[model samples]
Target: MERYFKRKTQPEILEPSPKSPKNNESSSKQTCVDSMEINSETLQYDPGLCTPILSYHPNVRDQVRRAYLQNKPCQPKTHAFPYTNFGTKPRRFNPAWFTQFPNWLEYSTSQDAAYCLCCYLFKPDIGDQSGGDTFVGVGFKNWKCKKKLEIHVGRPNSSHNSAWRNCEALLNQKQHIETVISKQTDQDRIDYRTRLGASVGVSRILLQQGLPFRGHDESENSLNQGNFLEILRWLRHSNEGIKAVTLENAPENLKLTSPDIQNDISSSISYEIISAITSDINDSLFSILVDESRDKSSKEQMAIVLRFVDKGHVIERFVGIEHVVDTKASSLKLAIDDFFSRHGLSISKLHGQGYDGVSNMQALVAVAKKNSEIGDLFTMVSSVVNIVVASSKRRDILREKHTHVVLEALENNELSSGQGFGDHKRFIAGIAKEGSRYCECNELGQYMQRMRESGWESLFDEVSSFCDKNRIKIPSMDDSFTSGERPNRKAHPITNVHRYRVDLFTDVIDKQLTELNDRFTEKNTKLLLCVACLSPINSFFAFDKEKLMRLAQFYPSDFSEHDLELLKEQLENYIWDMTSNSEFVDLKGISDLAQKMVGTKKDHTYPLVYLLLTLALILPVATASVERVFSAMNIVKNTLRNRMGDLWMNDCLVAYIEKDIFNSIEDEAIMQWFQNMKTRRGQLF
Candidate 1:
């Protein structure tokens, strides 16, 4: 090697020369000498400063000479023979015996053999042992050892020695695939794969790794195994759920999750997280923010969202969504209470309960329990039947009417003389039509029917004797069967037998009524005041007297004094002034915007308008979240869509979206927010 140095072209300058004029001869001589010296100096060449030719330096040269004597190279160097005195001739394939069939060039003796650098470095000598049948390829268990058995997960197959040795290999491959997917730039790369009904570029991963196959056991849930698809799922959710899907831990033999693998993973992991989070939460007291939502099917689905102090302020994680068959306040409260209990939590520990607008079901629940025949009991029983009615299976149970007939027949005796004397049929008919179910109580209906038959003459006597013994008196009432004249002029004969009805149907109407009032009309001045004491909140907040007086003009009543007083209280005190709220301010301005922007008028504030506005404020914030999730399911994880159960869908959504996530993940979420990667290397930048 040779080395030299030179400063890139730079100009030199002239300087005054020092001289003495002592003697003409000496001065002339000195002047000529000075001029000549000055001329020599002008060249200003310094061999010592020729950038030192670092290689030419005395100290370096001696060391270099010594090293050369020893036939050594500096820092790092490579030696190669320049030319060979003689070269051997190459052997040729014989065409005589080969027949020169295709007249093609000779074939190479090498196959496309490449080494997995990562495996070679971390697990040397593992190839020949694991190359399945030969040293040409790697087997599944070459690197696994007996001592590693405890730490290494094996196949369910008990053949301990045959258990896959390449778990680390598989895990490493998964890491690389995730890295590649993370580098993808196309926002819909996942969606594209999903639409084509192809794997999430998983096969590409195997191909990139030069692995012949992914080796998935169809019998074992692929999701359970750390397959590339699962990894892509993890990437999708992790990127969406967490801030990033990173390979920061991959090189360290650590893998993160599919954002919400919490939904599908082992309880041990969830428990560990809960314990970690709980141990860190202040006072070990977990604060909760719970609300209920409905699916497309409208099952009273309760979302158990949690808020607790993590490393910093309160973080709200949607723990999970629980589907409740009943939406009645008590039932809902009970369900929430039970959930808290199960999580080692308590209701009293509950700091807040967030729900949608308090309409019928909740308002009545918020109120005190009412008289058996009045608001409370009616609200309770009616809500029960409404729950049954809401379900298709249970709805069939009450349609038969066997249960309702028996109930109204038995209750007919309880009415005061003339009070509801002719309403038994109406009551039974009412029970028959509503959404309800009495399937479990069919035995009770049969017992009542037997009493109605002519053969059961002594049934009423036995009932009267038991009522006397139990100190329970049936209602005093005229014969409901004879309340009016029939064409035969005959009264219902056995109808006078002080009868009884099942407790279920007897309670459904008032509940629905209470719910209607609470949900639709509770905030209506007159209507709310009407059920003040009957409300779950009771008469705590006072309604404005002047407001009540103003609203009273809307109604016309020829009523009793007690009823009027009750009406006055409800009409005045049940006020939650939302008409002028901020949400409504936008509603008010919509009319103006329409006239200006699109030329329209906003008139009627139908109940639907209010409902939509309330939904916009509350409900959509909860359920509209499905838009993005369903989008992802269609695009990234469609393979599981139809197979998804209602409960599972909730889990998927929870993983797919975070808190206040609906509005956050608009169409722009895919384009503007996350950048998908094409490889782990892209992530390095």
Candidate 2:
């Protein structure tokens, strides 16, 4: 590991408290208390001390009344003698003072002097703070009253306010403490770099340790690995630079010397993200979807999606792309399987599969067959449904009626001789001819033309699913050999790789579907299968297939329409009519092999499923859905283009989808469980 460390430093002591032992400690002192006694040292006579001494004097009603009757001015009590000295010599009549004592004390401007009158009138008694009494109800459900408690406190004054004001300084103290902590950490990191003999920041940590900055890249930063390029990026968004604590705002990339290195960093980041995401997909069965489209440069790209089983299927996320050699099922399957192997996933775990084209449909069904629960395939039931329902949703009443007719026919036991005879043929022919005419419309016309395939789409999906359940294949590679050794190696359709590609190209995109570019992300060639993909053109496949193939991966034989050539000829023909003659169809797809880019090279035709997928990718649905994903990526890895290693970015990207898992998690409970984690090792933690 590249060593990096930081040290912690202790904080400094603060200035001492302001409390003092002596009142006259300061040279500029104001008030000094000497004595209240009637002696030469008496301070009441002094201007400063007289007011306070008078303020503390007790009230004498008789003396005040006597003074009032005598019409005497207010004066100090020096002349008045106590009874022992002179007061008992028959001069005790003092009823005039109370009548002469005027109104309350006046407000004064002086800060130091106090009004004796106001002090007597307003001074609060310390013992008077408690309230008189508090009442409490008593006795079980009865209404008896009882005195319970009393509480009282005086409001804040000058002395109390001094203590309360200390809070104003706390923020500064907290900031200082934080700064000290940060400095200590930086120091430790510096020490770590010195020990490791590596550079630190723009300046070397070793240099701070009294060693010279002595690396070749120390001078030329293309070689320098410290806070260089990061600084440049910071400069790009100048204000955010100082505040950004995120890895994105690091300044090293800013100073990095070369563009190629910058690009390498970028690519490295994306790769790391993709790698991390792929790894998460390895643990369980997942659905796969794919779309095919060509770039402006005419490169064929396969956008893949892996629908993972998170906490809930409704919130499941998709997006796992691979550039394959061709549109052939084998090549597409190879790309998918290779990716799975890279991510450490097993093919045996694959359960469900979906596709927009015939290639993906076949491949996914094949993979589903590997699962015991899938019973040798995902029944073609759903594919058949999507075709009809999707067509039905478009307000195609006759097609909907036809679907119900089949359901109705199945409800009734019959030979189903609904074709061939002239009377019946005329009835069917009129419907077929009517559909052919409706196919001329801009929208539902094409769907009308391939009504049968659209109807079969749902059937193929459902049937395959039914078979995959309770059935599975025994792969050839397993050491256990309980059965006969007469192996059928050629059973895999992938064996004829070239033929698969040719077949796919011919069937898929023979019509208007090839126009599915730059429309939407799900529709986009680069991101079609991504969650944000969208397009104006329709599509037919989204892949869900196993990456690896093994022999004996089957139960007792089950035969469907596919085993015989009759079904293939019928479907292939319908697919051709639907695509080749549709409006907005590309003619170059028909004549030029160069225009048909496949995995590694160009081709003229592909399998029926590819045709279906080509249609699906070009479909106008869910373009915005895929945009949401790429939008997240753009937000995550934007133009300041802060780079994350593939693993970390993948974690972030997947986090958007992992929301379902997170939602189901009782985080508070988990946190409570982990609250003691730090104490697990008795201080090591």
For each candidate, what TM-score against the reference? Answer: 0.22, 0.23
Model 1 — which ten-residue stretch has the worst lDDT? 72-81
**Clash totals in order:** 38, 132
lDDT of 2 by residue, 64-182 (tens): 22211121222221112112223334332122322333221111111111122212222233332222111000101111111111011124552212222322222222333434454
- Candidate 2 residue runs with Cα over 4 Å from true position: 1-254, 275-282, 315-320, 357-685
- What is the lDDT, from 0 to 100, of the residue 240 in candidate 1? 45
Candidate with maximal TM-score: 2
Compared with the true structure, what per-residue lDDT tens digits does model 1 show for residues 1-685? Answer: 2357553221111111122101122122221112111111111011101111111222232222221212111110011102212236333222231132211111111111111211211222322233311111221122222233222222443222232233223333235666656555553343322321222133223222322222234223544444544444555563542213323312232232232222222222222333333334434224444556545544555665555432212245555456677767887775664444234343333433445522323454444244344455668888998898899977777776755655565687643444453677676554432111111123223443444344344645677777885699765434443334443545335343332322222233344344444444334434333322111122223324554343333333322455456545543332332232233223222222222222221112222222111111111111222233334334322343234344344434443344243223233222211112111222212
TM-score of 1: 0.22
Worst 10 residues of 2 by lDDT: 133-142
Candidate 2 deviates by what RMSD? Answer: 35.2
**Model-by-model lDDT, in order?**
0.33, 0.31
Task: Predict model 1's lDDT versus the native.
Answer: 0.33
